[model samples]
Structures are given as C-alpha cells and as structure tokens.
Target: MTSSADAPRSGPVSAWAPLAIPAFRVLWFAQLGSNIGTWMQTVGAQWYLVDA
Candidate 1:
C-alpha cells in the first residue's frame, strides 16, 4: 500500500484561502471595520479627556 507521505499534492496552499468564501469575507470585513471604529472612538475619548 502507498504511504500518505508519498501522496501527490496539488500545490502550495494559500494562507488567505478561507477569505475566498463569500460569507466569511463579508464577516471578516465587517469585523475589521468594527475594530477600527472602536479604536478611533477610544482614541478620541482619550484626547477629549486630556484636553478637558
């Protein structure tokens, strides 16, 4: 019997292959935007507190 190590591979797999899925892509961008907004709000709050 052939060993698993001897099996042929299609090629190198991409790290971003999961982003190809439509639902996952949308969720990922949504999360990214949310995180950016949160960060900006935190920074703005800090600046306002410091300036007051």
Candidate 2:
C-alpha cells in the first residue's frame, strides 16, 4: 500500500500562468498581432488575384 507521502501530487495547471510574466505577455501579443496581419495580407492578395 502506498502512503500519502508516496502518492503523486497532482495539481491543476492554469493555462494563463505563462502570460503572468510581463516579457512573455508582451511577446505573445506581438506574435498574435503579426499572425493576424499576415492572415489579412494573404486574404487580400487572394481576393485581388481572383478579381484580376
């Protein structure tokens, strides 16, 4: 039989834990904005090509 001390400690992990860091939060937002801009540019190019 396993005692309480021998049992594995399972804890709930927060998804937003990493965003708690100021540097990480800044980089995350910057990356998100870059991805959105790239997506918009791609869509615009496709629409222009299709219409031309």
lDDT of 2: 0.95
Per-residue lDDT of 1-52 in model 2, one digit per residue for the tens? 9999798768986899899899999999999999999999999999999999
Q: What are the runs in model 2 whose C-alpha is more than 4 Å off?
A: 1-10
Instruction: Report the Cα lDDT for residue 16, model 2.
Output: 99
Local lDDT at 2 for model 1: 97
- Candidate 2's displacement at residue 42, Å, is 0.2
Per-residue lDDT over 18-42 for candidate 1, one digit per residue giving the tens place of the 0 to 100 score: 8999999999999999999999999
Candidate 1 lDDT at 47 equals 100
Give model 1's TM-score versus the native structure: 0.76
Model 2: weakest 10-residue lDDT segment is 5-14
Candidate 1: residue pairs that collide: none
